[model samples]
Target: MNILRRAAHAVLDLEKARCEKTVKLFRKLGLYRRILESTGTEPKIAAEIEAQMLSIMEEGILDQHTLCSRFVRGELAFVEFVQQWKVWYAEYCSWCDRVALDAFRQAA
Candidate 1:
């Protein structure tokens, strides 16, 4: 299936803006799974990859929520919160890309 190449291409094509909403993020993840499933990846392997991606997405959301909570509590200035969010989002995207690549390679 050339899983590694497919994964890399999909990750590269991912649109950060399109994934802003939680529902959209979930849909994006589902697309990833579908991409694998369509390529004849084993069901177990596809599920494992989806699990890994979901776990990473969950962690990112939790961290983002914590940041928002802190802002609401007046623990951070709006500017500071935005700066932190930018950094956090960048790291999250990088981690997502890495996980997708690694997961697909392992599956292959």
Candidate 2:
């Protein structure tokens, strides 16, 4: 297979493994519960996570390309990651806009 195709499959496999690891972690420690408890049962933790996620994506193309080459290329399912990332980005942007507007209204 070509490099790209091989790389893509490797990524998928890695993602699958990561998913399994995540599930195991959840089973052992309840990752969601821990996050909720740490964040004080507020949805703000979700916002914080999302914001950090978005910030990571804001890195330049070179940075992103390096990430794809080094980590995502063989660790993530490109199609699935792209799909989920777009959805998350949309939600995050919407939430950020709302937050900004709220702050503006309060300040004005």
Candidate 3:
């Protein structure tokens, strides 16, 4: 599969909002593997993937923050939101660290 095609597919799996079927189709395209292969120590591809992953993480965090804020304003129990947010935030940070670190190494 093409690099872009694979990245698109993996992106869906990693963080898709809708059209699960379509994304699944792309998911079947072996995007994650392709992306790693495409990188092939190219550095650029690594940077690209890193950039995309970080952006996705940021968006997820922002959305979750907004939702949590809304619940707070609504005087709702935010335990669930807070818990999920903390978990996701931790995962996101881990992902961010991995990608950003790769990007940094590539830039170096």
Candidate 4:
């Protein structure tokens, strides 16, 4: 029981660390501000992207490697990011819903 508790704590700590790291990356890369600034033409997309960004920060599961590469190379445009993130965010939401439903079913 002690060992199990320690393992669970470690996993939670790791997740917290990852989430903090991701948030730091987002700040360092100026992603949030840039996205906000660039989405003036599409308010709905802007809102969705903001929500997805928050979810990504919380989940710490986004593919940071690709995003970092594009950001570093100065090739990631607002339009491109929006389009890609929209699809990714939608899929992520769907997966979350499915997982929740599965858990409820199991509990029931």
lDDT of 3 by residue, 61-90 (tens): 456545555554544466877776788788
Return the TM-score for each candidate structure. 0.64, 0.33, 0.37, 0.41
User: Candidate 1: which pairs clash?
Assistant: none
Badly placed stretches (over 4 Å) of model 4 are: 1-60
Q: Mind sharing the TM-score for model 4?
A: 0.41
Q: What is the C-alpha lDDT profile of model 4 across 1-108, one tens digit per residue?
A: 657645655665576677778777876676754665574424444444545555655663445444434543446776877787777678777866665455335434
The residue-by-residue lDDT of candidate 2 on 29-92, one tens digit each, is 5454456447554455444444443443343223334445544445557776676567756766
Q: How much lDDT does each candidate structure score?
A: 0.71, 0.52, 0.58, 0.58
Residue 95 accuracy (lDDT) in model 3: 71
Top-TM-score structure, candidate number = 1
> Ten consecutive residues with minimal summed lDDT in candidate 3?
15-24
* Local lDDT at 27 for model 3: 46
Model 1 CA deviation exceeding 4 Å by range: 1-35
Task: State the lDDT of candidate 1 residue by residue for 1-28, as single tens digits.
Answer: 4575455445433532334466456656
Per-residue lDDT, model 4, residue 31, is: 72
Best by lDDT: 1
